[model samples]
Target: MTKRRALLSVSDKTGIVEFAKKLVSLDFEIISTGGTQKTLTDNQIETVGIESVTDFPEMLDGRVKTLHPKIHGGLLGKRSNEEHVETMKKHAILPIDLVCVNLYPFKETIQKRDVTEEEAIENIDIGGPSMLRSASKNCESVTVIIDPIDYETVISELSETGNTTLVTRKKLAAKAFRHTASYDALIADYLTNQVEEGEQESLTLTFDLKQSLRYGENSHQKASFYASSIPTAFSIASAKQLHGKELSYNNIKDADACLRMMSEFKSPTAVAVKHMNPCGIGNGKDIYTAFMNAYESDPVSIFGGIIALNREVDAKTAEKLANIFLEIIIAPSFSEEALEILTKKKNIRLLALEMREQKDISEKEYVSVLGGLLVQEMDTLVEDETTWKIVTKRQPTQTELEALVFANKCVKHVKSNAIVIANNERTLGIGAGQMNRVGSTKIALEQAKEQLDTAVLASDAFFPMADSVELIGQSGVKAIIQPGGSIKDQESIEMADKYGITMIFTDVRHFKH
Candidate 1:
């Protein structure tokens, strides 16, 4: 049997000494650098320093250790080729059969509030990625391990077969490449942010793979979850699933939508989502009342929908939720009694998302388009009596004004071009994702039917054409709230004036397509 050689370099030393001892027992020469070499040597396992093998010393503050051609040539050379063997013999370079490397903890280091720019830059690995990539590129000849968690399995495989199989090596190489890619992305994003603080042109995003889902939107497609390198206040990707089956693609999408909506409310709120749209949302004195009100909004649509609560779920709410066939329930916390009650339903997915402070107001909203993504400042503007401008002859009552504000809040969360019709505190009708503003207004009024006579309408954006105003008038909507900024705004105002309808301009558009 040929004498195999394995190089090890890792920031995480968990299980390293034991692994090195096992490899030594199997007669494999252990090659390592710096701290890794000391770690193995201190454990009484013989190890050769990488500098000695390369006939070069580590320089540039240990940054130039593993970048030598001898190290790469050993990893890249093919054992079966006579020409490669002769070249290695001519150069007097030993073959490296395996490479195990994990990158520096740049992410962990930067997460420290007291970390300086110099410290963050120092954590960016140079020689480690070069060695990993060189080893992975020649996976047909060498095994590359990027994660320490896989060390035991690799050692077990080698012990059983005397070598890692080709399939295993290929898998490990793919993992190594992904690790390097994620590491590089993090560094790039950090540098970009440091260079350009407030400009949209300088925005850089890096997302790390969190978990692979069961499937995509459909059973045929594949899907995975990626979390942003920059942490957010309350992200579904960061949430912990306490119990139940794996989340499907649809579940996560709906859950995220619901969570974003719930984040807007300060009171105890509950939102029920179906197919990435809110079926029901209500705020009440307590979580149980909120959930009950949301459920009562549309009980039929709540079936098999995802439910999210902004407050801790109590036993009363859990019992009510258990009676239905919901897909998932996300809340800040669940009482022990609530968990016991909910656990009786075997298929419901439960998640506990710790609430954090709201994100900074400056974070822009992003939406994916055909070829690129659209980024704009988030619409955090809210309407009050001072911000509302009444431009029509008719006046709104206090109750109608309150309903208008509530309906406007609902419209902001809906897909554009959207219109919401509500009376009192309950939504009477919602038209979302329509082609035109008029079309959405007509749909909302039509859904309200006779109730449109007294219901207040809230539009996400200004009506470019006066047809929407006429349509609302024909449907008997008494009052309207809209973000007025269209060039043809005067035409819409005239139409509402002619009908003697009450109109309030919020002056802030919320287009959420």
Candidate 2:
């Protein structure tokens, strides 16, 4: 009887020798190439060099090693077909019963800080994916393995039954295809980032399953978190949870919002988020003062909200945070005393993040629609104050200009039609997600009823009519900042001048849906 054959070529050689030894004990002949062959022979296990089977030398720096017909014919031949049998016998192609292959480290190579285009292209494996796909397509006749974690399972079945079971073959084949698809996806993403411009003709997205959530937006829906192949320092996917219960779907959304909001500030800052919108935001000299100002910004809305701080959490800050019933607290790090106190709340999530990974230039944002996906660049273009056009007769006071900048940053992250009223670097009231601009203006003005004096208002977009500006002026806000592109800009300017309020046009709009 002819000995069953197994081909092995892998980048990760975790247990290749042990797996090959087990196959040899089952009367299977091992076939390998390059480093894999060297490793097996060094372990005193026998292996048939791939050149002996292909009858061709590896050329083009090992790029042309496995493209020969003899290697593929053996892996692709239909064992049950008489025509296939005749062809194999005519070509002297021995049937291959198993194939194990893993692609080169393209993902890892591109992740390096100094990786160049040439280095990235060199790591793209051409022959590996082809073998895995061909073997997976004929899973009934051949078993395919891409991960070393499955070595023992395949070895166990072969040791007992002399062959992998049909079910195991089918399962491993599916996993192998997924492995190759993700590898190809990562390579495509790297190439696009390097040279491709604008939207591509096709969009390919691939992510690893990071977690399985208990529920989606609602308890009845199922959901899971898929992390991007490339890791970022500020991403919620990369955050390390020091203590907490499992994060829910809403918790992740709120935490992500808090992080984005916190990224807008340079000083020690605190951002509070609720229902995927900013409820309060504040900047201060230290973390403790920042938390206090954020809590005071909207004390009622901060309950059960997610809070993210740019600075480290100290004992003083943690003590103030402990008084609030928050769902999550995110920072660069936590003090020993701070962690000890916060850990007492068993259900709150405490996360530590590397705050310096702000690679804004290459960042992309993705949103899933009904049947398709929408992709765009992240809204990270730094707002330029040099482009501001003061349209009103009165110039803004120095204090009001600083307040307007702070209010503009907070308003940019709010859902439209959004309005933010702030003073002294702390948000007094935030109106978000209203259908009409004036309606949102009313909500913010009412919330800041007593704090309106010397407060500045920021609008995400130009007001369609003068009514919103009229209301903002009536609320005693001293300055207003907005993107000025609407047809009715003159009417709002007239209203601001009539109210003796300063209006500035940023010439850039931030519309968050």
Candidate 3:
């Protein structure tokens, strides 16, 4: 006639008092340890101390508490097996009907601005995961809860049926294992980071679900968004949504591309992105002019594109942005008037982020393949201007030099076979992801049209043949910037010299695939 026992120990003690009180009302005894015991007792809820059941003092700085056989036996003993019941009775062990446990704040501790190694190591929970796993392993009889979000469901079922249903227990057990697995993966990743680079033999990836997208690239494909465990303040994942409808998968993609392109300039810059390609990028003394320059670069493409500005958005820029049917607008902050005007459009999304360059941290990029992943360092390196060589006999003028560097930076973000034409520090035409270099050049040349007389061209890679340079010569491009590594480089250099075009070789290739 003894009541069933429930073990409750949690680092995140959210709603524990009410849960324990509900269990007590349903004829259950609450056994707790450490801070959890203090919290429940402080709330005037009677509880059984953990040592009373284990008969062993929590030694080694409270690390050796729940790893005892008494706790595990209570959780893992089979109720339907006669031999298991006899062994449990012989050992004087009680059956634990439920377990509610959550691990320590290891992720939160590591994310602190100045957290030390010892601080993070000390927060790794040992006994908590053991108890959760033991109970989850025998989930037919023992129910386990790892998240506070599931507490109400467990309580509701227990209140109605006097115990959790088999289906409910199975789901909670599966979740408990996943919780522990993710926690362990985070620890593994942290330890791997502590080691020297290239010493890690295994990859441990951990991410938390940020949201479930309405759809993926297409409406039929399901998708979700996940944020990395390590914080990135400047990234789109860290952005805070302030207004409008939910972000789709395509919106997140375009916004990420826009932010990455925006990081290339230190001035008040604006970037317009569509389909993961920068259609327009502009820099100026102020954000409004920067946005105007970007919009004017390609008005048709910027109509429903993602816009990212490095500086805070003002009412004037917001007014112009509101006039366009933009999918999203991201910035450091928005003026009160700007928000009032922009928020009137119910379908446009606004995201605010810290526009940090993040140069100090060596960030990484991951791409998924069919059965594995590809990891590489992010392409944030700033090529040395001193290393550039002027191969063309006609040296570029100072004005052409400034515009060439701007175009060089802009071209690196474009896809392969990319060509970016710019004048006065703003893109006039961009041709990306074409099949051949000549095709991209033709497309960019056609877009540049009248502006080709003064525009400078930047290609993501060197021309394998002189055909692209011959094509550029046919247009009136003044100067060219490319990562000249092809064996036919001299042919292109001769072609540029014949056309009186200034060509510079950067040596560093920026191929984005």
Candidate closest to the true structure, highest TM-score: 3
For model 2, give the 10-residue run with minimal summed lDDT.
Answer: 354-363
Clashes of 3: 0
Q: What is the lDDT, from 0 to 100, of the residue 420 in candidate 1?
A: 88
The Cα error of candidate 1 at residue 118, in Å, is 1.6
lDDT of 3 by residue, 1-513 (tens): 979999999988989999999999999999999999999999999999989998989899887889987899999999999999999999999999999999989999998889999999989999899998999999999999988899899999998988899999999999999889889999988877787557367787778899999999999999999988776777889899999899999998889888788788888999999899988999899999999999888989898899999999999999999999999999999999999999999989999987865553357789999999899988888889999999999999898999899999999899988999998669999999998999989888888887876799999999999999998898888799999999999999999999999999999888888
Q: Rate the local accuracy (lDDT) of all candidates.
A: 0.84, 0.90, 0.91
TM value for model 3: 0.97
Q: List the residue pairs that clash in candidate 1.
A: none
By lDDT, highest first, what's the ranking? 3, 2, 1
Segments of candidate 1 deviating more than 4 angstroms:
77-91, 197-206, 229-233, 360-388, 394-399, 446-454, 474-476
| Model 2 per-residue lDDT tens digits across residues 332-403 | 999999999999999989999967566642478889899988888888778879989999999999999999
